[model samples]
Target: MRYVKWTFYTLIALTVFAFLHYVLPQHDIVRITNTDTRRIDFGENSIFWASPDAGTGAAQATRDVKFIETIQQNGRPMVYRNEDTGWIWPPYFKFNSYNLQTEASDLRSTSADPRWVVVTHYGWRNEFFTIFPNAVAVRLAEGPNERIIPWTNIVILTLLAVAGIMLRRMWRQFRERTLDPLFGTAEEVWEDAGDRAGAARRGARTSWGRFKAWLRSLGS
Candidate 1:
């Protein structure tokens, strides 16, 4: 049982970590190699993709998805799909897919004279299942070795910590205001009952002693 409880807690922690890692924004500095658009079919791998364009009821299983081709500073190639996440989960509020496509196209560079860019995006690029991260914003970087501080991550974690503290304080307040009073009343009632029982027992003992004394006098 103890092992099972620890295993359950570990799974829950891992799930939360995965969820935050997926939903949070991350920055990648890379050189734009090329750009393309192709039709993608979101079948069993649908959960890996974001929601349809904003204000649309439902999205079809297949659609034309934009691609931003780039190469990282480490000489590894990376591809990101430019898609409108709409006003949904993760809440980037991004609706400028066409503009972003134009920007990425303009920033395209070759291997010889690489034009570095900071791709502010959220999601994951998986090669096996064919999933690409969604780009939210792009900016010109000084060079391939530009350092970007993760303010987004810091702010998000701080907000989560504040929320957790507030929730714990609220729970404690509710117990003090609501449940504590009832428990206090129950304790008082139990103490009073104990006192009454003690008095009744003493009175019975005194009456029995008098009865014994009277029987002894009668025998004499």
Candidate 2:
């Protein structure tokens, strides 16, 4: 019985650990916008340089000129251009254009941009690359989705509920085994105690008799 109790406690501890490792970290649901344009495009000379005569020069020209113009108009393009890579934008680029005041409040409230954007520049030889906008390269706490209860979370919680039920059943069984004799009209424990007491008394008498015999023999 003691071993069983220990085993159950150990299992409970393991379950708690698993819950912490897998479940706790997943408490908040991550709702990503699933933006369509978030992708890495690569190819041979896909990056075209603007003509030297063009405004902003060849260095400033980008294949995604239209997209950049749209972003610039909004004053929050969240668009990144790399000389090596064409155009890069977070999945949230479209959200910036939405008229928040006119759209459904829920949509406006829920929209968000990705927390971070990374731009990598690869050399023509593909041997070396650099990231641009070095001064403000990193953005934190800007992901597009809010946390929602994930399915894994639901499954873990269900398992925990089942475990709780099993624990309750075990407790009932344990109480029946330990407390029935004391409070459930069962005389088995009292009877066993009385039998043990009688045996102890007999053992004491036998010991006394043996001690007397030993003393008499010593005197003789």
Candidate 3:
């Protein structure tokens, strides 16, 4: 009975835990949607342009311009955009500021007059800083679904529930075994022993008196 009680309680506790784990989102993947530019105060007197992307906006702008020249290079999508002006890949823009900077520096070193080198690098850098943060925010805002539950977590929870039930049963069985010897049939056994002890005392008293009489007779 004790074991049963514990087992029931353990099962209840484990069931609650399992329910919570199942209901709560653990792993989530968010899709990027739209990109927007914003002006932010970065302390001091310096002002910078930042671009952020929207994850769930339907009215995002779509540009049909080919940024990458080769659509398929080694069967993989290659970036082919205008060499002079970098394009935004809405919702999933690549951080091409570093690449732009390298390209601008090379152009300056090779050419007699550096044209739009600095301007191109600055543009790419500004977009990279802004859009990356926005995309991250959108990803964070998205929630996880039930299908994302890990198999290991499920198995662990199931085992915990089973162990709780088993432990409760074992405890109950142990309690019953301990109580059966002392309370189940031991009452009758104790009563019989008490009666026998009384009879033994009465017989001893009578035998003592008979022995005294026999000794007095021999003396006379």
Q: For this target, which candidate reaches the highest lDDT against the unseen true structure?
A: 1
Each prediction's Cα lDDT score?
A: 0.90, 0.37, 0.38
Once fitted onto the true fold, the runs of candidate 2 whose alpha carbons sit more than 4 angstroms away are 1-15, 23-145, 174-220
After TM-score superposition, what is the CA distance of residue 110 in candidate 2 from its true location, in Å? 22
On the 0 to 100 scale, the lDDT of residue 219 in model 3 is 100
Candidate 2's residue-wise lDDT over 1-220, tens digit each?
9999999999999987754542122221122122222223334443322112223334432333211101211234332222221133211122221222122122121233422222111112222332112011112223424334456557867898999899999999988887764665547767788899999999999999999999999999
What's the distance in Å from true for residue 139, model 2?
20
List clashing residue pairs in candidate 3.
3-172, 7-168, 34-54, 51-130, 67-80, 67-81, 68-79, 68-80, 68-81, 69-80
**How displaced is residue 17 in candidate 1, in Å?**
1.3
| Model 2 vs truth, CA RMSD | 17.7
For candidate 1, the per-residue lDDT at 116 reads: 94
Native-referenced Cα lDDT, model 2:
0.37
Better of 1 and 2 by TM-score: 1
Candidate 2 vs candidate 3: the lDDT winner is 3
Q: What does the lDDT read for residue 29 in candidate 2?
A: 19
- Give the candidate order by descending lDDT: 1, 3, 2
